[model samples]
Target chain A: MQERSEPEAARGPRRGRGRRPTAEVRADVLDAAGALLLERGMGGFTIEAVAERAGVSKTTIYKWWPSKGALALDGYFHAVESVLAFPDSDDVEADLTAQLRAFVRILTGTPAGRVIAELIGQAQTDPELSAALLERYSDPRRELAVRRMRRAQTEGQLRPDVDPEVLVDQLWGACYHRLLMPSLPLVEEFATSLVANLLRGVRA
Target chain B: MQERSEPEAARGPRRGRGRRPTAEVRADVLDAAGALLLERGMGGFTIEAVAERAGVSKTTIYKWWPSKGALALDGYFHAVESVLAFPDSDDVEADLTAQLRAFVRILTGTPAGRVIAELIGQAQTDPELSAALLERYSDPRRELAVRRMRRAQTEGQLRPDVDPEVLVDQLWGACYHRLLMPSLPLVEEFATSLVANLLRGVRA
Candidate 1:
């Protein structure tokens, strides 16, 4: 396992708390950070730049994210979490079809493609950032997908022989590769065809 | 296709140079660039670093690559072009299984993982770089794999209904994902199981 470490912090957290901070303020800060990250590549961006973009005080930004990496990390989580949720349905094929297509759409159509590419790029260079992404960000989605696949297996819709972990790697890997090399169009028909073919081996 | 505007010279050779560089010097330069890309990450290193590491002068490096990006691009092409060459054999199953296993091994066991991740990351930020890698680096492999699968289909090894492109995408995607995610151990077992399952789906 790669060693996990905290990203560089801009400053230590506030020593004491008074009503802490509002949820709205945190959301605003994260949104600002996300924009900055997308606009300026990670290497070029700074804590003060994030503060300026968000129009929030540096103290407020520091209070929330100790380092620029942490802030970018949070921004990534907030931007991606909602999109990563899996769809549940009684019909495994329908559920998977929807989920996978939705995933391809988000990753390919939106700026999310560029964002993920950047994160993966940084992950190559930064062990701490890589570990955090795998643990905090990627792990959750992988677990969720695995759970869905396992449930499908138990329900007799999927083959008992299919390994949830392997399937997860296969599905996500396919998506990541497409994101990296955007040569082919990732249309719904393509997604349906892919899911059907993958399931043939995976279904019991 | 992404616009393929990379000057041929920018990639490796400038046809009409006064004196063609020696094979030994070219290989030395490529080795140096690859090492630097892996050790310091692309952003942290410079052309001078490559020259110093290779024990070659700056003039030697510039004579070959005009910019730092060009050096990295050529090095990546050299690595992938060498690595992505699939072995030829009469038995379809044996050939693909060996090739896929070899592909996984090369990506994980060597610094190729870092190089690819870096290339993808750069592609996200730079249009020209992205186009160059896709055209020069990624597409050839995809075409080769697809051609092999299509041949399998003709030989009655693959299901007639299966899309060769999708099959190649899934196989390469799964392998690429495992390579980039450091936590996953690139075991032969996973490769074997993945191929077995994939064939199960592909076989008539």
Candidate 2:
């Protein structure tokens, strides 16, 4: 495993004092941050702008997230977490299809996808930023799918011989291919066919 | 297709006079640019620095390429093109294995890979940069693989029913997945296995 830095969740609220900030404030800040990211691109985005747009103080924002990248990361995750809920079902085929389809929807269909693309771009040069993205955005999410596949393997829905990680890669690789290279359109049918073809090899 | 501003190749040799600069001068500039990219990274990279390093004027550099991005792109292709060559043989399996293994070697084993990663990140934020990357880096290269697959199909080595584009995506997507996320080591065995398994589905 590539060495991962401790995630932001490990370093929680700096200001854990009087009247803990409400969930509404969190939502408002994230909403504003997401909007600023899309409108200004990564270059024009700033903590102060998020503060102004969200109607929250910079101190409040800093209390939650250490830096602008961290704050934007929070907003990015907010956009992602809402869309990519974990899937658990006995019917492996149905479950995998739904999960992949939902993934494609958020990645291709939403403004959130653009934020992700920008973050991915930024992460390329910045090791700390890349580590943070992997820890927060990729790991927990990938783990959920890993567990689901393991359970399916245990139940004999998938080939025991096939490595779960490779299976995951097979399912996700094409979707990301479309996302990174936008020449080809990413319709729902792509996911359906990708899953169907990969399942032929992995299914018990 | 996103409208492409003319490429550097199209705008070559503006300083065409009595003593035209030798090909060695072109090679020197690209080498310097590639070195600067490795040493200082994308943020610190600039055309002026490349000009100073290459011992050429900014006007000289601009005479060949329209922008810094274009110059860096030339250097990047220089780094990559030297490494990746097309595979053509009567034996389809041997041919693909060689092609993919060489690809993985370049992507996993060189500074060009880092350049590619940085470019991918930059491409996410800049549409023009993204288009340049797609046009210059990805499309031409991917088309080679697609053509190879289509030829294999015509030769009755691959299944006629399978879409050549999907086949290309299946092969390249996994490589990109490894590049974008580096948890798993991309050994030669991975390429060999990926091609073997993918070919199983597509083989006649």
The 0-to-1 C-alpha lDDT of every candidate, in the order given, reads: 0.68, 0.70
Task: Provide the clash count, candidate 1.
Answer: 5
Model 2: residues with Cα > 4 Å off, grouped in runs: A1-17, A20-57, A201-204, B1-61, B201-204
TM-score of chain A, cand. 1: 0.73
Q: What clash pairs does model 2 have? A: A121-B121
Q: Which stretches of candidate 1 lie over 4 Å from their true place?
A: A1-17, A20-57, A201-204, B1-66, B79-84, B202-204
DockQ-based CAPRI category assigned to the predicted complex of candidate 2:
acceptable
Q: Name the 10 consecutive residues with the lowest summed lDDT in model 2 chain A.
A: A1-10
- Tens-place lDDT per residue, model 1, A1-204, is 011123324323521233336675677677767666655556656788766555467897888665666677778677666666667777877877788888777666666666677777667667787877776567777788889888888888777887777766666667787777766766667778767776775222
Query: Which candidate has the top score in TM-score?
Result: 2
The top-ranked prediction according to lDDT is: 2
TM-score of each: 0.74, 0.75
lDDT of 2 by residue, B124-202 (tens): 8788887877777678777878888788888887767666666566667777766776656667777776666665431
